[model samples]
Target chain A: METELSKRLGIEHAIFGFTPFPAVAAAISRAGGLGVLGAVRYTAPGDLARDLDWMQEHTGGRPYGLDVVMPAGKVEGVTEADVEAMIPEGHRRFVEELLTKHGVPPLPAGEASGWRITGWMEHVARSQLDVAFDYPIKLLANALGSPPADVVGRAHDRGVLVAALAGSAVHARRHAEAGIDIVVAQGYEAGGHTGEIASMVLTPEVVDAVGPLPVLAAGGIGSGEQIAAGLALGAQGVWLGSVWLTTTEADLHSRALTAKLLAAGSGDTVRSRALTGKPARQLRTEWTDAWDDPDGPGTLPMPLQGLLVAEAVSRIQKHGTEPLLGTPVGQIVGRMNSERSVRQVFDELTRGFERAVDRVQRIAGRSAS
Target chain B: METELSKRLGIEHAIFGFTPFPAVAAAISRAGGLGVLGAVRYTAPGDLARDLDWMQEHTGGRPYGLDVVMPAGKVEGVTEADVEAMIPEGHRRFVEELLTKHGVPPLPAGEASGWRITGWMEHVARSQLDVAFDYPIKLLANALGSPPADVVGRAHDRGVLVAALAGSAVHARRHAEAGIDIVVAQGYEAGGHTGEIASMVLTPEVVDAVGPLPVLAAGGIGSGEQIAAGLALGAQGVWLGSVWLTTTEADLHSRALTAKLLAAGSGDTVRSRALTGKPARQLRTEWTDAWDDPDGPGTLPMPLQGLLVAEAVSRIQKHGTEPLLGTPVGQIVGRMNSERSVRQVFDELTRGFERAVDRVQRIAGRSAS
Candidate 1:
């Protein structure tokens, strides 16, 4: 389970765990892998700073990183209200009708819905970055590939390693040319935004495209055997996201959603644009089906879609609608059958990885003899 | 590369090479891997008998197999003209308009379009099987999963091992229960007929589902490293289809198709129902796009779609229409960048598999030390 990535990142294992919960991030770091706290949920700068403070206190001097969902540009001065106004009335009505059809109750009075779009705004993302550098953070990752050149320079100035997720070799080469310290070769089976290429083809292609740069294989990887396969495909390490959703430390916001995830199989997931206005792999729900229907009004673009669906998503989670409850998850959700502690998952991963390596070695040895 | 599959199948390498060409099949058996020739193209029983005779003379005492594309049922008395008449006039006009729009000329008066339907009828497949048993074929495979129980018993009676392709653990379990000797876990990235699950998730699931039954990992496997990864994922061996399309023994019908495959990348392939009325992965071309267009008359069901498109496909190939010419291929086409002999491909796969195994062993060894 150890490789150049582990040595370079000063971790005991070559595993990078991505989570939005600070508790999970701290637990992952405490368990010997780099724990990346997703910053998209922390729309306010102070909220992110508060989480960083908690991570600093709980990580036991272990390294932790932050992930921001910002596009590559110098975004400035656009407020959430401006983006909110861009959503069309027809789209709003379509969401209301669908939610009504599904019998999802509205939120209680004075309970504001979740705000995920603000963090995607360039200025809010920059503000989050400004707060992140104040902590002992070791990595700054851009969810939508490489951040602006100036942003990379700023992270480098603060001794932070810059990484970006690429779905193909073309994007990986671009990230390398943009001076990214690492490339996360996320494949079609990944939870969030992904391209059409699967990991078996993408990993080797990215590894060859970005020669000498560390590549972490992502998507369709849940167990240690898959991790071993990732390494066999020439990746320096592995990055996992959806497997953590069912961990004891994860705050999935609903018990029903957790139950749904546990009962799902690999075939239960589907790639749809309903989640984030881009093609993202998630559990197939009535919500996704409605959006994908031929007669339904099509989904809007990024920030606009997020703005339109924010309240509907909140209502679904709040009410725990059985057929409508889901989160962004990969096909590996099939293997997340039960709840386990983060440390226990790591133990199984290392053991399984070693077993796979030993098995392959024995086979190869016998072949040669 | 030694596994229980290699030992039981009595092959020198744990590899199954699938091709439609008799020459490629003979060469694969000569190279110590099992070559399963696709039998769906042999509509006439006499044609299949001639090829089986050729295979017997050229296999050089090595084992080979045959794959027939017949559904599990008793099919009789249906002629190709009956299936052809079932196609609607609107669909016929669509195909003709599409070819004319592409400037593809009509075939010379006496040239008949290729016939691929008769073999899919169970009676034709049974006749092909009758001719096949006359040769020393060691394996009999059903391309569309397990054939009828009677067919399975018949193969067993002939001392031939029966194998079938499965796209999910549920399907694998069904195949195992039906007395299939081997299960081929074909994944989403596979060429031609495939399931939605990728190999990384499908292989281990099938292996666990059909305990003690051998599973061969297919899809996204083109190189030795992928083969090593497949074995690591708990498969007894690897099943490869697309990589052979560019091999020297492949009769690709036209130089144009060969050049298209050589220049394509992993992202160039798309899974569309434009072919065979089922979702099959193939190189994206204008022909696929025209069928996939929302404005066009939708594709018909199985044998009908095959009937509707056969003439258009022949015209495209005969004219060497650059934008319209394509074939069934997997994402692994990204790696098949050049034409080489089957022996050369096998040599590279073995070396790559060994190197990957050695590399993982070193990492595990260092971690343990």
Candidate 2:
């Protein structure tokens, strides 16, 4: 029952579960799929290292992956000082004002909660990468864009697969050209930063563009039938994000956020840069509303925008206020209501895949008869 | 320099456009945001005539409205006799034989040329109401379940505004409690049949369950600022279909049966059974891969399954020889690359609206700050 992707990742199924929670990632790996932990929310390399070590012990040496945000383009690649200087004072002031208005208390001087825009660029990424290398992670994925060649080469030298997220065929080609091992064709329906492309079209295009390279389809994939559809369209495996956000083990917001997500239909999500300074699909909320307001100051760029609002975002989450806390999810969230274990979700998917295969065969058999 | 939609229909902006030719609809409307046709593809009015007529004249009048098939529930209110009786004996034999051979053709009939599955439905729809009643149609819509009562009563009585299409939100709260002015919230993406809900969360939960009902957001809308992200959430106007098919003015394959719509993006389209008997989506091809496949003869009862493979379907469009012709469309079809003219394709929609607004605003000293 090993899937093509599972063979590549040395797992049983091609299912790759993405989560910010180490427990869920471990659950998926224990259940026979690769669970990849998202490292964006962590403030320090030590935090990521601790989580990876925990996953390693829990999964009993099952293969897993590490995901990092490697932005394709940035304002500057110069020294941290140079990049910080590039940040407009107005933008920084705007961030402060936004937090104050939102009633988020500033962090204590020694808290190290917020970093300036471009503050967490290469330096932080490289540190995290170093920590990840120490772990037994079988795969290393760049969540936002292509990993630097050196990073990919280093991972390859360690026998770790290097994967990158691609929103379009053009992006997929870039990953392939960079000698990446895998390309995750994430459609606009996916959570976090994404492009305006659907899975059906993007999957085949990326598969074609990358030629022999394996592609993992992401975004809006919840059921086995969709996974089957992705496979039919040429993806080797499915990369799921939103579905995990609703799982019983997920570290999701309280009842309010869950209710909103359950009640929402596919159209409820919007691709706004308000959260990540990149077009990421998220649950629409008043916070997003404020940023989208024409009169309100527009969103600042990456890291900086995130930095400015990190504390505010945390407070809102801690409070579990629906209007204040926005969750990053995809259109698939509309279909995610009931709480299930990662294993249960996997079983459903497998069942669905079997059904789809049976269905396709029945159709083909009837035609043949 | 007003758009044809604005000038002819006398609307404020040409921001609303719906059509089977999603590309034409998007191009004309997005260029100036004022082009709408009709979702003639799914309406069961006996072929696509009535729907087409409404789209033609309405968009012809002001570049507005798209009529489509939008079934609310799965195959409800249908009988075995109903399905069996609809297909001519000769056609049934042809379909059975075709199914016995290479599986059902990927498309119903219109994939290549001639009338398609909607052909009969279009004919029935044509007789149900007199589109001519709305002499100068501003917009046209359809409900997968049923057209709104007031929409029928008022539009016919006033000779203005055409409405059709509805799915979910309790069928748009009974078309906004029968006051239906223009409520089309179709999901499933695009193409023939739809459902499976994915209009980015069913177009703002059917605009908060049809408040002040002036919505026209269909499945798979294409473009960056389509109605802007604002309009998409609860749009006053945003309707799209498969934006992949050839336009009336573009050259199409005469033999390749399946319309190359399956290759479309999230912005491409969806599939549903409002057209035939089951919910399915695929490129209209010689083999109706999603429907006629024997493994899942599980097509929901429609005008019964007989309507699923009506004789007219096969004759309407053949594969590998004639692909230019297919039936219906969703907003995703905006991807189709070509152009046409509903009064030169509403030149004003693409150019005139902005210029006219600019002139008026300049005169009023209200230019942007």
Top DockQ prediction, candidate number: 1
User: DockQ numbers for every candidate?
Assistant: 0.79, 0.05
Candidate 2 regions with alpha-carbon error over 4 angstroms: A72-120, A253-264, A363-369, B1-145, B148-244, B247-369
lDDT of 1 by residue, A1-369 (tens): 678778777888888999999999999999999999999988789999999999999999999899998788644667778888888899999989888988988999999887466677788888998999999899998899678899899989988999999999999999999998999999888888899988888888998899799999999899989988998999888899999999999998899999999999999998988978988999999999988888889888886788789889989999999898878999899899999999999889888888888778766754221
Model 1 lDDT per residue over B2-106, tens place: 787787778988899999999999999999999999998888889888888899899899999999986875546777788888999999998988888889998
What value does the lDDT take at residue B93 in candidate 1? Answer: 91
| Model 1 misplaced regions, further than 4 Å | A74-77, A366-369, B74-77, B366-369
Error (Å) of candidate 1 at residue A267 is: 1.2
In model 2 chain B, where is the ten-residue run with the lowest total lDDT?
Answer: B356-365
List the candidates' TM-scores in order.
0.97, 0.59
lDDT: which candidate is best? 1
What is the C-alpha local distance difference test score of each model?
A: 0.88, 0.60
